[model samples]
Target: MTVIKNAELTAGNSFTQNQALGLLTELVPVSLNNINGREIQTTSAKKLHAYLGVGRDFSNWIKGRIEEYGFIYEQDYINFDSPNLANQSTESVQIKQWKTKRGGDRRSKDYCISLGMAKELAMVERNEQGRAVRRYFIQCEERLQHIAPQDVRKLRDQLKARITAANDFKPMCAALELARAEQGKLTQAHHYTSESNMIARLVLGGLTAKRWATGNGISGDPRNSMSADQLKHLSYLEQSNITLIELGWDYHQRKTELTRLSQRHLAKQLEVAND
Candidate 1:
């Protein structure tokens, strides 16, 4: 009889990306709130709670899997389900990763393995070319910038709704990078990269990989782990080698930096393996 090693795994298994997504989704109904100065108020927070419900349903399912099988570190604010790879004589594996940073001049997937495993994926992609995302925010922010607190709250709600709609839209970006180098000298080579690729690469540089996710769980603003839109971008940023935290996002509506890496994860792959 065939056997599955993890068949016995249950809710108590540990925390994982899938479990975490589920937990967060379940919390959406109770999570919405607003950023007030530095404090989170009940009224403003309600909108986000709603987003956690229907919008990020996909992400929520992923989180649920993590929360179920992975171990949750509330204090560390991180959860890990995969076995630690700190010590092991590893063999080659066709691991897929995102291009966290541009590899100086190398081609062929630029960089991979920057973002974590697939469960971290989110359906919300960047804004398409023709649509205007900031257009709505730009006008709204200006209109409410100097209004009274109560009045600002009203406008914020309107902006929030627009942001939600924008999240569902597929935004286009200018990709400008060699899709991949030619087999030989480019005496004759079709351009593989597009404007969308270039922009995708740049934006990937700002994402938050799994290793950096919990530690950087949307800083500054406790009002959000990361906004729904930002989370969506980062989710799509998965294969791009960026994480949500890496992108210039407003955790507390403030830009935050991710932890530095001592070396590229792909370095090992490029290294001369002792055959």
Candidate 2:
């Protein structure tokens, strides 16, 4: 067993090109797992098991695969079973517990396995779903290899621009709220939150900024923790919302328009990412 230094996992900076392409997202969502002080692309073994239609219980299936393949612990995978391990590390590590089919709450151990290990496991399963999953992983790897360093830097620059724009929007929004209050048009004190939550819901698929922050173990603004693609989507919606606000559109109308715009923007971004 390899002793993992800094055995803590945090969110990665950006989504991979494969994710942007929506190739492996539905089948098995990949994330960056911190291991040995480096971030490696990994997927949840439990999710993979479900996708591959594995008949065995999750615990037995995962353990059996690890033992059969001689996978090194803390190298190919890491278990989020020990709460003490999280306390020892400075980084935020969220240990998720789920309810069973019978509605019993259970905190089961989850394994984040490296992409290489996942592919190997998929290949060994020798079933149709397994073969399809393995092929998808291969395609993901191929797309990832094509993402140049300059492409990454471009995305980073876009994220920075969007963040700055969002910060600038806050003061402007406050001023608008202040004017509304002066004219007796403001009905609530949380106008800033309302506007921000509107954009967040549209971009984040109904998850408000506050809920996203709480779920991710993030404090303060959740925008700081968002991925580049997410920021881009958010910034666009903010700008659109500002325009609708100035036009005297009602909340429901703005929301409807923003929802449509978000869908178009996401599709366009996906096309760009694929290119």
Candidate 3:
């Protein structure tokens, strides 16, 4: 049995590119609303409640999850008054009620969470409906971004850019440095580094960063001396390892999964690259 070091599975957002594609297949077009003067896509708590088939008292459930997960109020969700309310006094007041259905009850204030937060909430919800809702959120993201998976290079570049923009290269460098810190650590704890090299060989024309840099006569920190293409492949490996770690995969399990994913990605890239 593989022993997961940090098995707090609740930490990961649990979203993936393949799952995002699956979500895109099930999407229904809806007009996205604006938030704070920016056009944004969001799903209401009421809609999610109905979709999830949770009981009518979903407000309590939503509140529970929001508080439990420490989801930021303005960032993850927002409460606002309904403009369609009949009472002028009520209209002026910030009411946060949602109708259970289209014409159901407007008993309380309505809460709206971003699609991303919805996916995270769904991961913890652990029900079939919750899974479906998570897919919907991924679909929302795909549609919003206009993702085209057929273009492998384009997609890889986009993911690489997004990961790079969101995270400092320090994490990637740190992971590499940690891998080289000790041979035992590399072979045992950081086995994913080996799989990463395997993936890099296929995608980068049979060359890992260190090997490539050495062959080209570059000295010191092959990671720092990587070409753009080599860096992108390294980024993908780093992301794979990070995702596995976040999902609470044990060291060995992560290595196995990383190997499989890297091989799969390499195959896909080959198909597209050859086309």
Best by TM-score: 2
Q: Put down candidate 1 lDDT per residue, 135-163, tens digits, no spaces.
A: 22233344444555665565455446435
Please tell me which predicted candidate would have the highest lDDT against the true structure.
2
Q: Residue 85: error of model 1 in Å?
A: 44
The per-model lDDT (C-alpha) reads 0.29, 0.69, 0.56
Evaluated at residue 78, the lDDT of candidate 1 is 30
Counting clashing residue pairs in each candidate, in order, gives: 61, 0, 6
Cα-based TM-score, every candidate: 0.18, 0.42, 0.36
lDDT minimum window of 10 residues, candidate 3: 1-10
Per-residue lDDT value at 247 in model 1: 41
Give lDDT tens digits, candidate 3, residues 1-275. 11112221233547544543354333322336644322456776655665555553665888888888897765567786433333223324344643333444444566777666777866775765566557666666676566534443443454465457237344644564455454344434344456456545644567875687678776544543343454555567667776565555555786577667767766777898899
Lowest summed lDDT across 10 adjacent residues in model 1 is found at 109-118
| Per-residue accuracy of model 2 over 1-275 as CA lDDT, tens digit each | 11111111113525443343354476587766665433556888877887777779778999999999999776688887622122222343445633344444445577989888999998998775566677777766656657655554654565586566677577548655755766678546487778778888887778998898787676545665566678777877777777777776767898899999999998998898899
- Higher-lDDT candidate of 2 and 3: 2
C-alpha positional error of residue 95 in candidate 3 after TM-score superposition, expressed in Å: 23
Over the full model, what C-alpha lDDT does candidate 1 score relative to the true structure? 0.29
